[model samples]
Structures are given as structure tokens and as C-alpha cells.
Target: MPTNQLTAGVCSLLNEPQHTEDLLNSTPIVQILSVKKVHSNPNAPNPVDRYRIIVSDGEHFLQSMLATQLNHFVDEGKIQKNTICRLDKFTCNMVQEKRLLIVLEISVLEQCEEKIGSPAGLQIPPGDAAVTPSTANQTPAAHHTAAATGGATASTSNTTTPAARGQGARSGRGPTTFPIEGLSPYQNNWTIRARVTNKSDIRTWSNQRGEGKLFNVTFMDETGEIRGTAFNLAVDALYDKLEEGKVYYVSKAKVNLAKKQFSNVANEYELGLEKNTEIEECRDSSSFPVVRYNFIDLAKLQEMAKDSICDVIAVVKETGDATEFTSKFGRTSTKRELTVVDRSGYSVRLTLWAKNAEKFTNTDSPVVALKGVKVGDFGGRNLSMSSSSTLEINPDIPECHALRGWFDASGNSENFQSHTNSFSGAGGAATFNRSELMSIEEVKAKDLGTSDKTDFFSTRATVMHLKADNIAYPACPTQGCNKKVFDQHDGWRCEKCDRSFEKPEYRYIISMAVSDHTGQAWFQGFNELGETLFQRPANDLVAIRERDEAKFNKLVEDVNGHQFNFTCRAKQDTYNETTRVRYGVQKILPLDYAEEARHLIELLSSPWAQ
Candidate 1:
């Protein structure tokens, strides 16, 4: 093909003569001069279709090819600026705004040829060709024998011809690596330089087998984020060395299909660092961005469902009771509850368990930041705190001061109320009547004239008739459920279930009579508080009532006529919708209404009065 028919535009772009004889008759070959321009074509069906060229001596030939094709040339082909390419031929058709050219053939040549050659034969000088037989015979016999023995080695070295080297260099497996671009579609092994956004300290776990240590770190590259865990030996190798906010050249990581349900990121896959994984600290810190979060308002946390994780900033309004308990592992644990409030006109309870409880006990009035706190249900509303949750007390972070100022300026402190108004020494003394002190058996035995108008009230009642002594038994020690149990020796048996269990049951009250200056009421207590007030094991009380009624009556008399201040709470029962009240004696003191006893004391002290 001759090059004469090439257009002036092509000639000017190629900076070469345009002639039909040179294009059609002469070798139809050309060298890539330059990539003058590259851009996507909107008119193409595939939006990724692009137009580019190798300005071989610039018959500015425009070609319509897939975007992937251009990427292949840049990636696999290793084509770059100033690269030389030989264009065998191309299809050109005139278009309105831009010329359209389709590349038909191409050859990446090292350099431009000085002279054109015939299509039949191409030759080089004799010195450049392989040695002839005459040249080989000119050497000595001993030299020939040595050459024969080393012929295999010589052949091995010659086997990698210049052509082979060029092909190998272009195979996309060379030491001069390049970053992958336009990877929105391809899913394959990829190397990225990511920074250690978060790292975990070495944590040890002990089991029957042995004790081992493990740690994990979170990494973030420009492309995405991933989590890596190191165990045992790996922990010792990398735990102290891997620092947060430092970049690292990580490679040999295994890419696994990510479970979207378990991940919060946007990527479809995640990487795992294995034993063979390589990591090297990157000196340049400017390559990665700092970790940050736009925390959600704490007031909004009320609207979220229980167990929902949230980030919040709020002021600590008040600290709560610190309760200590034994965990399943037989370890002592303590937890303190606090109320955290924000500008949203809503507040939630935060229970800091274990270490957090002790640490925040003295932080009575400080602003706090909570991340990954699990919302929970407490007293019919959402509460939040978790073991993995992070709590910052009066941190230098701006959010802390902002929330503090807002709370102070808005008079938010005035709105803070005790979690339990009635139980926190707020409500005054309680009162109860004799009729309300009737035991369950007594109430059932009584044949009242009318249910609504029953005159059950009585004065000077003995504690013997007020307590459910016969029915009292050790109840389950579980936090919420406190049903009485039957003794089985091996373990206490639950009367409600007719089953034997391992854990020891607790003492709880089935009923109690409470009175004050105004009125009287019947009350019940669950296991823990019930046992505390009764001052006896529920099982022992039950046994005493069954074996010796006279003794039980004496014990009741000891508590009778004991004038004491009390507090009570009433809530409608779910079974009958009847109000069931519970009360505890707050303060017990000598009765002022005992006139006979006062006279006796005055008679004994007559000398002072005289």
C-alpha cells in the first residue's frame, strides 16, 4: 500500500510526506510518533469508547476503540508518553467535527528505520549474522572440544534473543510495576499502599489447650478499607511495630469475598493479611487522610431501636448506684449507671460496666463522647452502653466543649430528674391499714359480705397475721425471676416448675404489711431486696412456719407495733389489673404514742423530776 493518499491532516500530525506511492506501493509501515490526544467518544454505544493515536511520522489517524483497549495499551502494553509505535495500516473516513480512524495493524518498534526495504527480503551485514562453517573451522581442535562442551550454556544464553526480551518486557510481569487504573469493573488481585488507620494491642486468651495472643488492625487505602488480624507468633512480630496513622507498603494479602451484612464499608471485597503477607512502613504521611466522623446527635439516640450502635456527645447529668456482682466466670464485676443528655430534649441511661464503671465514678459532671455504644431498653426506653464501646471523659475534642456550653447556656441541668423519684428519698413516708396486711391464706379464707364494700380494716394488728410465713421459700437467684423453690439436697427444686436445679435459691417475701400515718397496704418483694428486709433465708422461714407455728408467731410479734417510716411504689398487675404495692421500712424508731411505757419511764426517773 502507498502512503500518498494520506490526508494533509495526517501528514501534518505525522510530520511526513504524504504520497500514494509511498503508502500503497512502498512498504505500508509507519512508526508511532506521539499520542497527540486521547478522549472518550460520547457518540459510541459503549460510553467507554475512546479515540487515540500513535503519531507515526502524524498522519493523525483517529481510531474508535473500546476504553478497555486503550487501557490495555497503557497497562499491559506499557504504552506511555514519548513511546514509539509502527502503524502497519489504518481505516480513515471523514466526519463532521472530527476525523474517525480505525487502527488496522501496529508494531511497537525500538527506533525509526533509516531506509525502506523490499517486502521480499530483509538482510543485515555479515558481521551481524550468525558465524558461518568457515569461521568455526578457523578455531583449534582443543577450542572446538571446549566449545562443544559449553555449547549448551552458550545456547541457553542465546536463546533469549532481543525479540524474546522485548516480548518478555511487554508481558506485564516486570519489576517496573505500575498502579492499576480504571478498575471499577475488574475483580482481581491488586496491590495497594494503605495506612494503618487503627491497631489493636496484643490480647491474650487462655483455654484448656493453651494460652495464645492475638491482635488486629484496620487499614485504609485510597481505594477502600480492610481489617487484618495477627495471631500468636504474628502478634509478637507486628503488634508493637504497627502504629496507627502510619502508611505501609503491604503486599501478598489474600482477597476474600466480603459479607455485606457484617461490614459497614462500600467495597464488595475485603483483604486478609496472612503469614506470608509483607508490610513495610511508608515514610510519607501525606498519602493518607485522618480518620474522622461526624457524630450523630445524642438526642436522636432515643429514636433509635435498642441494640443499635451509635456515636454521641453529651453531658453527664448524674451518676447512679455502683452495683457489684459475680460474673459467670466467677470474677467480680461492677457497673455504674449514668444519665447522658443532649440538646434534643431527650436523655438516655448509660451503664458503664466493669472498668469503665470504676473509671467514670468520679467524673460526676463532665462531658463525654461515646463511639459504638449499643442502645438498650431500660425502664421502657432506649439506653446505651457496650463492652466494645469507647468512652471519652472531658476529652480535649471540640465536641466535648460544644456540648458542655450548650447544656450550661440552655439551663438543661434544671430538667435533670432522678431516675427513680419515689425510691430516691423524694416521696414522703407511706401509710397502710390493717386490712391490707391480710396474708394470702387469710384473704382467701375470709367470707367478706361484699367484694366492693368489704370492711377488712382493723387496728392493732400483729405482724404474725401480716406476713406470708407459710409460703416463704428460697427463690431463684436470677436477676429478674425470683420464684420460690423446694429443697432437693443436690440442688433446690423450683415449686413453679417441679424441676431440680443446681444453683442455690434465695430468700424473698411473698407479701408484707406496710403502714404509715395515713393508710396501710399489702406489699411483695422479689428475691434480693425481699431477703434483705426479712433478715432470714426464705427456705428457713418456710420450714419454721411449717414445723413450729408458735415460734413463727413469736418472731412476728418481734416486728409488730414497730413504728417506722416507709416508702412504697404501686403498679397495676398484668393478671388482674389490680394495683399491687410494695414498701420497705426506711427508718424504725420508738413509738411516741405508747403512753403506758412513757409513764413507766417517768416513774423510774422520779428523782430528777422532784
Candidate 2:
């Protein structure tokens, strides 16, 4: 073909060319240039873009072709910019100031002519050396390099090409071969250059079929990402060998539809490692990218709704006592609660029950980093922690240590408080001079209070008043409702509720008059202590008080004038729109007037306030 005729033909085929040049000396080398403008193809629905390239041969022109259909060449090592490429038969032409080219199928010349101290003028050998129609079956040297590097190699013949290996491959069928493009359909035979982003530890479970180990690992490529799992023998073979952040040429794996709700990866299907699965590490760093995240601040934790999963960084403000309880799974486990707070000006309770509690307690002033921890509520406030959640103590992350320092410097440690109340308060009290106090031995010696009004409070009292003989009958068990129960023989009646009940309740009245040098006060005890002081079972006392009022009052007065010394506390209680201060007798002692007088004198003389 004539040079101009071939150039014109190729230009017509490509629609344009940026530049064109001709060389007559030294085997008539032809050079084409000015390839700045190339329009994309509207007909190509997949890639949707096309470019026009220039081609040339020193002598005769072969044929013209479209740039979009040419194979892409990615040079590994650096190449000089605009360096002349030796073409066996090619031409550069222009359509309308745009560059166009046609490449003739020919072998690259072994030698070149010199020009300006640089190689120029592509040279071609005689007839046999030229690539004829039959020689096209020979694969290029680049194809072998690709194969050795575990990359996708183009086959010289259509029948010998490798099968596609990615998505859309039918199960049980061999791999399919396809061309490479910006976003080509993934075939079953293609090997993808991907990196191991994450790997999970192998886990085993046993059932009727058998026991086996399975673990999943996440892989990412320039094109997309997918998760793959190794089962049984694959676990032992690949679990420990797989390193994260390393690239690999992966192919021949099984592909199955993935549950969208279960995974966040972009691919609709996940990969599985089979016996014939191929994975080779890619040493090229430029082929893989790192994972990135925009972590949320710990201070924003409180603003998130309860049960919302989030990441957090906080110092351990306090550690709770480990408690063991039975779980729904029938396992007895221990757990502890820890208070964690950050600069956000709020604190949250983290329950580290069981093994976590034990492990956390061993850390020295731990600062915890939690990922995917669920916010929870305890005692009406927000809390967070998780069992399957990821937790790190004093992680290398700066936020971990920063929060620790802030918590320590802010005196947060000293302000730690329990999340729940464990004790109740006293109601009312009367003060007595120390002189009136007597020991339990003395009380037992004098036999002060009778069995009736046995309830008493006193300072310097002994266990004699606490003896079973001094206790009254039982009281109601309606939480916080401490009214005495009356026995009606058939069952019991509650004074507070004014209702009759089948079950008789127990109660004790710890009422005693305390006399101090400054003043005299009355005290009382209800519920547990009341039953204890009366020396009667709470149920029995409830029965007696309910059915036999005369007996109950007589029992109360028998201990009168006994002068049982006691101590009491006074507190305010509101009922029916009125607030009343009630007195609770704390302790009681049998009086020895002389001994009481002596103790009272000592107390009065003491420097401590009355």
C-alpha cells in the first residue's frame, strides 16, 4: 500500500489525526505525531470512551485500524517521553486537527538507524522476518513476562487464553475468557490482583455432619472488594499464612450470592477458597491501597441513642466488684462494671462482665478503645460495652493515652460513685446523756425492759437487747410499707393497706424512749430490726399483733420503767401532704443507774459535742 494512501485510509477509519511525518532516507522511515485530540466513541456502551493514536513504518504502509480496539501496553520501567517507537508498518494521519493512527501487524525491528545521536527509523528484516498471517499465532515476549509475574497474559491464539475468574461465572462450569477494560464483566477464569485487607481467626463448630474450622478474610482490588472464607483443611493451610495489607493474584475460587444485610462490602457476591484456589503474593506496592476511616469522637457518644453501636476512647474512672450470675444459656458467669469518660463532659457505665472484667482488672489504669460498642441504659443513664465488640487497652492510638491523662488530671478518680444505692437512712432520734447509758451485761443483770415494751434504743448497749427474747412479732413485707400486721386467726390484716390477706406477715416495733442530759426522745424500728428486737418470728408477731391487741399492749408495757438506755436518729417523712419527723431507736441497754451515771459523766466531760 502507498504511504499516503494507507495514511489516508487509516485517517478515514479513525476519523482524525493530530500530526503526520514522512522519512525517505534509511529504509524510508515514517513518523507520525500531534496526537493531542481524540474523541470518545458513543457506540461503545461499556467503556464509553475512545482515543485516536498515530502509527508509522519507515517504508510501506500496511493498514489502518481504530485506536479503541488496540491492546493497551503498560510499561513497567521508565521510558523517555515521546521516544520514537519503531513500527514495522503503520501511519499517522489527521482527520480534523485530531490525531489518528493505524498499526500494521509486524515484528519489532532488532536494529534502528541513528539520528541526532539517538535511535530512529524503524528497520525490518527480509520476507521471513516479517510477521505474516501464519506467524500471528506466536505469542509476544510481553505475554511471557505477564505470565511469570502472575498477571493476566494475553494468548496468541484464541483457544489457549486463560478462563475468566471473577463474578458472574456459573457454578460447576470452567472459567471463561474475556477482554480487559475499565469496567469489564468479571468472568470465572480471570485472576484479580487484590490485597488481604482483613483476616479472621479460625473457629470450629460440631454438628451431625462433622466438626470443621472456618474463617473469613476480606480482599480488595483496584476494581472492587470481596470476602472469602476458608473451611476445614484450608483453615490450617492458609489461616496463619495469610498476612494483611499484602497483595495477591487470586483466581479459581468459588463465587456465591452474598447476604446483603450481613456484609457491608460493595460486591454482591462473596468468594470461597476451594482446594484448587490460587493465591500468590504481589510484591508490587503500587497495586494495593490502605483502608481508611473517619472515626467518630468519643465525646459524641452520649448524643447517640441507646443500643446504637459506635467507637469510643475513655479512661477507666472506676471498676465495680465482679458479680457472678446464671445466664440464659445456663452458664454461671462473672461480670464487672467500669465507669469510662472522655473530654465530652459526660461519663458512661461499661459492663465488662465475666472474662472481660477479669482481664480488665489486671490492667494498670487502663484506657479503653472500643469499636462497635452498643450504647445501653443502666439505672436511667447511658452505658456502653459489648461481648463480641473489639476492645483495646491503652491502644497505640493517641486518643487512648490523651483520655487517660485528662481523666487522671481532672480528679475524676476521687469522684467515682456507685450506680445504685445499697443502704437506707434513719428516721428520727433522741439524745441521752452518757451517764444514763448501761452495758448489755448490766442490762441483763437488772433485767430492765419487760417482754411487752421490749423495743428500746440506748448508747453503750450490748447484744442482750438483740437477743431473740427481746424481739416482737413480724411486720408487712410490702416494700417500704412497714406497717404492723394484725392476726385475725383466719389470716392477717394490714393496718397500712386496711386490707385482709391470707399470708400473715412479720414485723417488729423498735420503739424506745431515750433520755439524755440535754433532752428525751422516742425511737422506733420497723421491719427486719423490729422483728429481731421483739425476740419473736416476724410472722408470729404479726399474728399476735393482729388478733390480740390486749395481749400486744400488755406485752409492750411489761418492760416499762425498766429505764433501758438507747440511741435513736430522727428523720423527716412526708405523708398525706404533711411532713413529720420520725424517730428510730438504734440500740438499747439494761440500766445500771450508778454505772449509767458514771458513763454519762464521762460523756458529758468529753470534748466531743453532745
TM-score of each: 0.38, 0.33
Residue-level lDDT tens digits of model 1 in 271-340: 5556667777767657254443336765565455545556677787878777674443434568787877
What C-alpha RMSD separates each model from the true structure?
Answer: 27.3, 27.6
How many backbone clashes can be found in candidate 2? 75
TM-score, cand. 1: 0.38
